[model samples]
Target chain A: MERILFGDNQFFAVNHISDEKSRAQAIKFKDDSAIIKVLDDAMAAGINTFMCTTHDRIANICDVIRDNPKKYKDFKIYPCMPYAHKYANAVTELGIVGTLKQYVPGNFFGSLFKGGVAYINKDFISIMELLVDAEMKMFKGINTPVIFLQNVITDLLLGLGMNELLIAFAKHVESKYNAEAGFITMNLPKLLSVLEEGGIKNPIICASINKVNFRMSGGKELYEEVLKQGRCRVIAMQVLGGGAIPPKEALEYVANLPNVESILFGASSKQNIQNTVETIKYHDNQRVLVE
Target chain B: MLKVALIGAGKMGISHLSILGAHPDVEIVGVCDTSKIVSDVLEKYSGFSCYTDYLKMVDTTKPDAVFVAVPTKFHYKMVKDLLDRNIHVFSEKPFCLNPTESNELFLLAKKKGLVNQVGYHNKFVGTFQEVKKLVKEGFIGEPQHFLGEAYGPVVIKKKSETWRSDPNEGGGCLMDYASHVIDLINDILSPINSCKGAMLKSIYSKQVDDAVYALVGIESGTTGVISVNWSDETYRKMSTSVTIIGSKGKIVSDANELKVYFKSDEHPKGYSKGWNVKYVTDLTEEVNFYLRGEEYSSQIDYFVKAVQGEVPNTVNTFESAWKTDLSISIIKNNSK
Candidate 1:
């Protein structure tokens, strides 16, 4: 039986962390608190698995795990590293020039600079070198399984040309770093087709259902296609469309999707977490309309 | 009580037909188009009779209100003929091939006291409306600079020696597409000082430019950049985004979405992220508001209301003429 995992995807806003200093603080403050609450709430609700992205947030999450290893002894926390190489130059430039204020605040720049210290002053090529360096450092001492979450939006915008660099990066991380690397995408058919074309040997590809209009088409197709792939497990996120979906429907849809190994959701408050648990238990066996 | 006839059974005509078909106060008595196939299809779909000759259709139908969805080149003659028959007109964009012809239509409409409206749907998009509201509310402080871009790959694949491809036939991205954004710029900015742009044939090798880029300077000292291009893919690449940078904050409305960001003193703990983004959903509200009608069942509603003296014609002939003039000037200067 594929286990249903519950966690919030809400960390520091990925786009908001414009600079390294703010990114580091956000890592220490916002992301740290959000992950702790998400994991604590999931454990209380009998959910053993928690999934999140690997941005600056992961550093703080790893710190928390190291500090309170006993509290998370029984829980499995999966941190997916976001593919940041595409805009690494832009992000790093914003950090150094301090013009990050044009887009966001000063703290955001500080966090990004601190979190991205190794690549803060590096050029585009050197940024890539740092990404490989960070990947190596992350794999060296980490005993827990690290699932690097590869996002496609940056790839599409940065002209990485989709699936080519993505597959190569996944293969490198898996083979070179010996980490469990998988492709996560909003486009299921394209991702699966690319994986097949690239001959990706990784066994755990996941997909997320994002956007309100796409909730029906993308969400349903992703649920079924992941099962069909069989080699890869599915991780579903954005269950609420950033709090747009009706609460009851959100829980039921996540619980009922066949072959879904885990569902990641974000909560702004304690009640939001409790309410999700209640909504999931409300319709235990009865099939409900997938929102 | 006014009877209405629709010319051109294309997308806009059918949309108007559906609205007029449902209005309790109006009667969509007839429809006309050059293509018997198109007329027959729309006639069957709308359950109305279709005619080939517009003059004959108008005479036979005796429509008090006529919606002209014909090509821009035909707008001058068709509108002139309709107004000569004392019929009010609701025509689609590119009111005329040039400003002079558009001015003639305006004068003719005025002489006949006929209600006239040109289609500029982007002005009615909810996000733009909200941005206008934010500008009024000083949410983004004093609006200083405005930039807009509207680009799309041309949808009509088979370009014949059609008028749209001919500069004389209102065939350019500026007139066909940029008019919406231009109208929006006029609506938001007061006292237009000067409008200048470069119209280039960047993408296609046709007679007319496939892309146009222009700079509009409002009398308010707010400079704006406008870009219109026809190099978009099969999907609609039309994006009407406006960013007004003010001293206090900024207000932006992309036709795809709308948002206004400003620095707040209160700074609620969580709200520190930035200005919250809100999606606008109601298109009808703005349409009806501009039409000065309680409800807009069809574009015909505005035409009928203007004809019956129920509301002042929101889009007068002068505005249409000005839009045409501005479009022609921008295209002529930019086509380097």
Candidate 2:
């Protein structure tokens, strides 16, 4: 695992700051080549891991990567699954029955009946497993070291007290995919405790971490306490606080933290990619010297 | 025509066989291998005679030269027998398992006035060749420090029943993989003078080391470090690179391209002071070999030209590889 991982938020226009900027990004990166160009720029700048969503266009990206095995051999993708927008759109356009028929694997008619029965019985775990398998079908042959449950589902599960589903997701990801399950949550401190209760020890948790308490739900102090005391592995995302903190200060703060294993970020331009990577490395070296 | 015989049907031996068999001015007289299947296949396709015993093949074919691509453990004995018959020889690198044997073979070749070369084919890579050219041209003036790295997924798991995993036969990453980088560095810069520290770690194989790290000083007062790992699965292919720092500028190179960064404007024409990247495709000769890049064929062509007495053996000579073996000796001794 690299200390720096490039995120795919910019490609899908998931800008946290403003919807206007998000729409602009969505328009800017409407093409698959645009996404690949930025990823190549990140690779040239020495970042190897792409912590990304399972967006439909990303399947095209995976096609490019699979075709040129020599160029992207070392490049790994940490797929954040269940791109919520995709599912929502599919359900709206096709209806519930049609969506289930289209997405579910195995005998289509059999799956429809099974899905109907499961929905009637409120068997959300079976539905969740089927959806996970559906989401994972895109990255069939690629190297995905960490399979992340998107924060939407993670925080939803956390709010519902459905901790056992997290355990099942982790176990399925391990047994079938042979990858460690990662959870992205707004409430890291609570999620850590719940995940521990569910038997996922030393879970890899990706959360918003910044200097000014940007998205640090349950506050920043509690997050820090859990990071210091808990057994969870931390990957700090939104270190810039949705463009609130200065890049240098935000990176310096996160790079000097105690238990953050990696920093995940998104940038559109080559210069920005190079600058951010250099800044992180520079600050990391400074921290090493000071300590 | 120069008559050549090949001994061994392993990976490198196949590379040499294809190049030699395809040469216009060369005739592959025989190919000798321990496996009858391998020998029969070569003979069927190449129309070259095949034999199980190398000595018998040499006696019958009476080849003008021999390409010894066997394992390192057999290089000394096989090459010594061929050289005793006053035949030109091209053997693979780490000339032998022992430096003493390498020195003896080198001297014997010189005494016999026979053309002798080692298979440090990296020297023929277009980017590496350009790096050497820039160094000799004083582009990176007065080398200060150099870093050589070679990493790949050659032995990530415990591999047994192969000579490569045996320390006495293959010498693990230090000998099998790092030798190429050491040979390249020695070719580009000054010879190593002393080793400060060295570590050989066995990650998967119990009998041999899979990783090597060393800090050394060259005779020109330049510090150098080399790190090699044969267990890195992150690489889709083997990654070997060299970065050299100097007072005026620096040259960073790999198999694909060369990046030159100059501090001041004293570089050759078409190159500026700041930075320039040149890919091997732009500098490499047209590829003629079947399995590999132009460098593989280029090395064989150089050897064929050397054997024909048209050009002196300047690259990958026994003497040069003997020097690399001396550095390997120092590294292995220091690590222990």
Candidate 3:
């Protein structure tokens, strides 16, 4: 994982601070070239990894990256599964059976027969694997080092006490794609314990970690306690607490934390991206000197 | 731990079950759903008492509170039954189908002195909470006009019929999507007392309206417009936003952030005369068990606290939901 990974929330109009800004972004990035331009900006700031959801628009972005193989030789994408809306739109257009046929890949009847078997035998793991294959279609032939389960499904599974599914996802991703399976959740502490119980050691987890505990379930103390124990490798996100915390203070807090191998952030402008990278580096340097 | 039971195991019901399962102060006494498959799986995996019959679940569990997440047609009868049993209840939004039924339930809950809530979770969003506070404090002095909108790709093309495709059972965009906006406008500004005109357009659905455009009048002597569309493919999910303009300045907010501009030097603390922006993460309060968003868990937490009498029933109460239901009815009538 890169120390600093560029995110895709801004391109998808997922601003956490301002609806006006989100609308503005929806207009600004209406074209795929605009998204590529921002990627270029992040690269210019010496950032190469793009951590993003599997939105349909990302397929087009992937096409651009695949076309310019020379320019993006070191560029990588960490694709998160079940971009939710894609499947939702599919389910709306086609019924449940139609949805499976649409995304299951391979011969339509063959996949249907497999899904039927999975459903009859109550073998959800097989269905989950097939879905991962479906979501991976867009990222074919790309440098995807890690595939993630979005928090929507991750936390739901956590609440349902479905640790087996998480473990299955980890094993399948590693075996099939030769990539580490990452989990994103709001409740980091609980997820960590569950993953550990299932024998998935030092899982790569991304969660909201900041000075104020914004979106951090189980609170800041529990997060600090887990990080102290070094139970897992964490990718700290929402470090600015959705723009609530000041940049310097937020990054300093995360940068000094233990086992936080990476910081994920999203910014539309090059100046904002550069300033963030600089602040993170400054705080990291200060931590090293203090040590 | 408070004794709690869940009735209905649909998508929303499962989410509620998940959050409640992890709640420290909640004990899952029973779960009721008509589907044997749902109840059996939940019973096996979660180790909770599950029943295919609602009446049997209630009689056996005798829960202190019950979360009613069944379809719309079942809400009034089931919620009324739970309230009659003196059990606190939380029903999913679009409170009840008609104003009369919702009004009766609201009054009954109020008269019986039983705790009641509806699941309009947007109220728990931090930016919207900030928007509520600013509006209450007259951040935009002397409210003049406002606009509420929600758009997504729900019914972009024709598909098989479900509860959502029926106006009576689904309530279409006017209930499923617009009710959130109506509830927000009523909660943030003032109760929507009247609606002048409404247009229920069926861009895709055969029986129900896909888009709702309405002119509404509120109790604060202000009128506003509501525009909601479920067929808009530009958005990935349902996105709601509100803009309010007043004599002093203006305010615009969404689930993500709140933006305000004041004309004079009378700015709120940490805000300036010019445009000021606040993010949801800045204002969100932490919860014990989080699923999708902080708001989802926050809403349930508030309900649990309310059940314990630790907090008053002020937000998302049965009364507030009734007002929204009445607004939906008014829109339907005016559109006709």
Q: Which model scores highest in TM-score? A: 3
Query: Which stretches in model 3 have alpha-carbon errors above 4 Å?
Result: A67-71, A88-121, B35-41, B263-268, B272-274
Candidate 3 Cα lDDT to native: 0.86
Q: Could you give the CAPRI-style class of model 3? A: acceptable
When summed lDDT is taken over every stretch of 10 residues in candidate 2 chain B, the lowest stretch is B284-293
Of the two candidates 1 and 3, the one with more favorable TM-score, higher being better, is 3
lDDT of 2 at B262: 92
Candidate with more favorable, higher DockQ: 2 or 3: 3
Q: What lDDT tens digits, residue by residue, belong to model 2 across residues B194-261?
A: 89999999999788888999999877778989999988865434678899998889898887767899
The alpha-carbon RMSD over the true interface for every model, in angstroms, is: 21.4, 28.0, 3.1
Chain A of candidate 1 compared with the true chain A, TM-score: 0.64
Candidate 1 per-residue C-alpha lDDT over B90-192 given as tens digits, one digit per residue, 9 for 90 to 100: 8888788777788788888877787888876665555676777667766567777887667654533434344556777776677777766677776766534
Provide DockQ values for all models, in the order shown.
0.02, 0.01, 0.45
Q: How many Å off is the CA of A93 in candidate 3?
A: 8.1
How well docked is model 1, in DockQ terms? 0.02
